[model samples]
Target: MPEPPDPADPHQPIPHSAPWWRHAVIYQVYPRSFADADGDGIGDLPGVTSRLPYLADLGVDAVWLSPFYVSPMADAGYDVADYRDVDPLFGTLADADELIARAHELGIRVLVDLVPNHTSDEHAWFREALAAGPGSRERARYVFRDGSGPDGSEPPNNWKSVFGGLAWTRVQEADGSPGQWYLHLFDDKQPDLDWRNPEVVEEFHDVLRFWLDRGVDGFRVDVAHSLVKAEGLPDWTVRTGMLGDQGEDGTEDAGEPATTDPRTKELGPMWDQEEVHEIYRGWRRVLEEYNPSGDPDQDRILCAEAWLPSQERTMRYVRPDEMHQAFNFQFLEMSWRAEDVREVVDTSLRAADEVGAPTTWVLSNHDVVRHASRLGLPVGSPRPNGIGAGSEQPNPVLGLRRARAATTLMMALPGSAYVYNGEELGLPDHTALPDRLRQDPAFHRTAGVELGRDGCRVPLPWVADEPSYGFGPGPRSWLPQPLLYGPLAADRQEGVSSSTLELYRTLLRLRREHDLGVGGLHWEGGWGPDVLAFRNAREDGRPVTVVANLGEDLLDLPEGLEVLVASGRLEDGRLPQDTTVWLA
Candidate 1:
C-alpha cells in the first residue's frame, strides 16, 4: 500500500488576500457580453457597474475589463478610434470614471483594457496618415512600405493579417492613385502603429497617464508582446498554423507542439523579441507610483497578454521591473494528462521563482475556447483558433467535470489565477451558433474555414425566464443564446449549493482561508499515474493537498484525511473520476 499522505491544515485560520494584484485572483470581464443596460442589446459600463456586487460576492480581487474604448466596431472595439474616450456604444467617459469609482467602493480594483498595437482606420492619426503622401511625417507613424513588384502592385513582402488576407492594405494616394501599402496585423480597419517612431512612443506614455490620472487602477495591455519587431523586418523562417492571417494583436501561441522535449524555438521576426522588455520597464515606472504596498487597496498592476514560445520566455516579462503579471499561455495549452499538468506547473513555478514574481495561472480567455468544452475533447486535439463548425463536438458532461477539476487544480496551486467571465457557471461554448449571427472577424475573413472566437463570446444569461435571459431589458441578445442557458442562468444557480457558481464561491473562500495562493507546491507520486496530487504548504506548516483524478477508475484517499472541499460529490470514501478534492 502507498504511504499515507502528509497531514494537511484542516482547521487553520485563513487571512485576507494581499494587495489587489500582488497575490490575488483576477476575473476577466469581456464587457460586451457581461451585462447589457439601457436595453440596447449590448453590454455597457453601467451594466458592469451594476454587477460589481456580484463580483465581490464571488471573491475575486480585481476585474479586468476588455476594451470599451471608442471604436467603429469593425473588430468589436479592438479597432480603437480613440484610446482616451469611451465609445458611446458602451458609455461615455464619465460613465467609465463612475464605473471605476463604484468598483473601488466595493474593495474591488478595476483594470481597463488598453490596445496599443493598432488603431481603427477611422482614428484621427490614421486619417492623417491617409491624407498625407508616402514618406510624409504623418505616414511615418505607421508601417507603410514601397511595394516590390512593377508599378508597386505587390505587397512590400509576404506578411499575413491575423484576420485574413495579406497584412498590407493598399491605400489611395492624395492624388487619387493606388499608392503605398500600410501594414495591419489584424483587420484592415486597424492599422499597426510604428513603435520605432518617437511620436508613437510618446503618445502611449500620454495615454497611460490619461487613464492613471483617472480613478482607474491599471491596464491589461493588449498585444503586449508585439509592440516591437526585428531590426531589418526579416522574412519568416519558422511558419506555424494557417496562412493569410497571422495577427490578433500577436497573442497567437504559434501553434506549438505538445512534446516535452527540451528544445529552443525561434518565434521569428515579429514575436517575443528581446526589445519588448525595455518598453515594459518603462510602464513599470508608471505603475510604481500607485503600487505602494502600504495602501494595498489602491495598488496598480500591468498584465501582459503575451503568448511566447514557452512559459520560461513568458517569465522575462515579469522580471521585477517589467510587468507585474504575464498570462501563462503554456499552462493553458497543457493537455489533461497527469505528467503534462505536472510538467507545466513545475516549469511555471520554477520560472517565476527565479524572477521573484508570483506564478499566474489562467484556464480560459475571450479569444480562446471555453475550458469546459475544450477539456472534453481528446487531450491532444488541434485547437486551431476556434473549433471549425461540425469538426468535432465535445462531450458537455465530461467537459464540465474536467473544467471543475481543472479549476480546483489551478486554484490550489501557489500563485494568483484568473477566472474568465461565465466560467463559474460551467458555461460551454455555444458551438452551434448560426453562421449569420457570427460577428468574429476570424470567421468571415476565413470564409467559415476558421470558426473564430464567437462561440465563446455569446452574451451571458442572468435569469432563466427573463427576456434575453436577463442579459438586458431588450427582447433579444446581440448574439443568439443556446437553449440550455435557461437552466444555467445565474438566477437558477444563485442559491443552489450544488451549482457551479456556488462551488466557485466556496472554493475561493476556502482558498483564502487556507493560504494556498502564497506558498510552494510539491507533487506526491504514490497515488498512481492517473491521479495528480500536490501539496501547497505555507510557512505555518499547514499543507493543503489538491488531488485531481483524470482516469475512469476511482482513487481512494487514505483514512483520516478530512475533506475540506471537492469538485464533485464523493463516491463512498473515494474521489470520483474527473473530480478534485482538497484534503488535510
Candidate 2:
C-alpha cells in the first residue's frame, strides 16, 4: 500500500495507506442487475465475486452494492427485514464472505448500502413492536400514535411518503384487533424507526459494527438526512394531492404548500441535528476503533445519499465529525448547458470549502433518467403544424461524446467520483418497460404520473448475443435487457479499440496514474455560455485544466494549456463539437 497524499495538497494525490476507497473511484453495482450466478434470473454475491476481475480492469478502486440485505422485495431491497443477513434471493452469508475475500484479493473495496431510516413491516423488530401493546418499550422503537382527530378523520400530520401517499399506516395488534398507526417514509410495509429511541440507535450501531467486523470496507448510507424527524409533529399547512388533510387549526389546511413539503425547509434546521452528529460521531469512532493499525484517529470512508438541492445543506453531511462525502446531486440535475455544469461545479467547490470537507460528483444514478436518453438528439417526421413528432433515434456519436465528456469532467473534479453501473458503456435509458412490467414502487403507486426508475435499473449486458444478453443464461431476467445492449456487452467490447468501455478504462487509468483522483478543484473563469472550465491542483504541485463543450459548436482553449485528454480531437487549441479536454 502507498502512503496517503498530504491532506493539505491532495492533487499530488497518493493512494490511501490502508484502503483505496479514501480517494477511490467507486463503481455502483445494482446486485440484482449486475450478474446472475445461479441461473436463477437474478444477480447474487457469487455473481459479483465472479465479476471482480472485470471491475478491477475498469480501474475502479471500490464497488458499492445497493441494498442486498434480507427483504420482502416490497421496495426492492430498501425495505430491509434483517440488516445482518443477505437476502436468500441474492445469496447466502457464505457467499457475501466469499465476495469480500475475492474483491479484496482483486484490490477492490466493497461498500454495502445501510438503510437505517426504515425497516420492513415483516422484520422481527417491527413485528415485535406490533405484538407489544401501545406505550410498551418495544412499541417505542417506531413512531406509534392514536388515531386521527376528534372527528375520526385523517393522520397526525400531512406528511406524504416518497412513494406517493400518507406516511402513516395502521398495524394490527398482537390481540388480532385494529391497532394504532405507525410512520413509514416510503411504502406501507416499510415503517420508519424512531431514532430518538436510544435502543434503536444502539442496535443500529451494532448492525454497522457487524459489517465492519465482517471486513466490509464502508457504507453508502441511504436517506442519511431522514434519520431524524421534527419532534413536534406539527400538521403540514401546505396541502397538495393526497397529503393535504384537515388539521386542528379549525380549517382543514394547516401545513405549508406541497412544493414546500418536498424541500422540507421547516425541517432543515433539524435535518442534521446535534443528535444526528452524535450518532455519526459514534459510528465514526467505532470505525476508527476497529482500524487495523489499532489507532482511533485514523480515517475511514462513509458516503451519504443526500438529495437536498442546497449545497450548504448538503455539505453538513460531510465533515470530520460527519460523513466523509455526500452525493452532490447538482450534476445529476444539470442540463446540457455548459453554463449549468460550470455553476454546479463552482457552487459545489464553495460548499465543500465552507464545511471544511471534500466534494463528490455523480452524473447518473438509479433514480435519474439516463444521460444518453436525456441528451440524445430527438428525431421524427414533421407534424401537420410542421413540428416534428416526439420520436427520435439517439445520435450514437453524440451519445458517446457526452459520455466521455462527462467521465472526464467527473474524474478531474476533486474528491471521489462515482460511476454508475452500465454508465461506462453509454447505456441509454430503456423506454420499453410496459406499465405491467414496471417494478418501481414510485411508478407503480403513482400509476406512471411519476417517472419510473426502471429505465436506469435495467439488467447489465455481459455477453452479447447470449440469452437475456448474458444478464442470465436463461430467457428471463429481473428486468428486460434492450436488444441494443446485446451488441454492447462487456465481452464484445473487451480489447476492442475505440469502444466506450475502452474510453472509460483509459480515463480511469489516467486518473490513477496522474493522482487526479484526489485534489482541490478551482474554477478560474466565469461560466462560458457553452463551456465548463476548471483546474485541479494537487499538493504535489501538479495542476490539470479541464474544459468541456456542453454546446454543439466548437470551443477555443485558453493559451498555454496542453491537451492531455479530450472527448473529441483538439485542433490548434480549440475543442471540436461536443468535446471535452484535459490540459496540463
**lDDT (0-100) at residue 60 of candidate 2?**
92
Number of backbone collisions per candidate: 4, 11
**TM-score of every prediction relative to native:** 0.93, 0.87
Q: Runs in model 2 with CA error above 4 Å?
A: 1-22, 151-153, 237-274, 292-299, 377-400, 522-528, 556-563, 569-574
Off by over 4 Å in 1: 1-19, 237-264, 291-297
| Candidate 2: C-alpha lDDT | 0.73
Instruction: Indicate the worst ten consecutive residues by lDDT in candidate 2.
Output: 380-389
Best by lDDT: 1
Q: Candidate 1's residue-wise lDDT over 232-303, tens digit each?
A: 676552332222123332233334441111134456566667877888888888767765564756667888
Residue 91 lDDT in candidate 1: 92
Q: Which candidate is the best by TM-score?
A: 1
lDDT string, candidate 2, 1-584, tens digits:
98753332323233234234445788999898898988888888888888889999999988899999999999889999999999999999999999999998998888889998889989999888887789999889998887777743457676666666677887667788766888776788889888889999899889988998888888999878777777766655432222222222212233332223443443433244456666777777777767769542334568888666468877877777778888887666565666667677767776776676666778777766566665554322111100011334456667667767777778877667899999888887775566667787766665554545777788899888788888777878887777888878888888876677887898888777767756656565654577677677766766888888776666777778676767666767678766778888
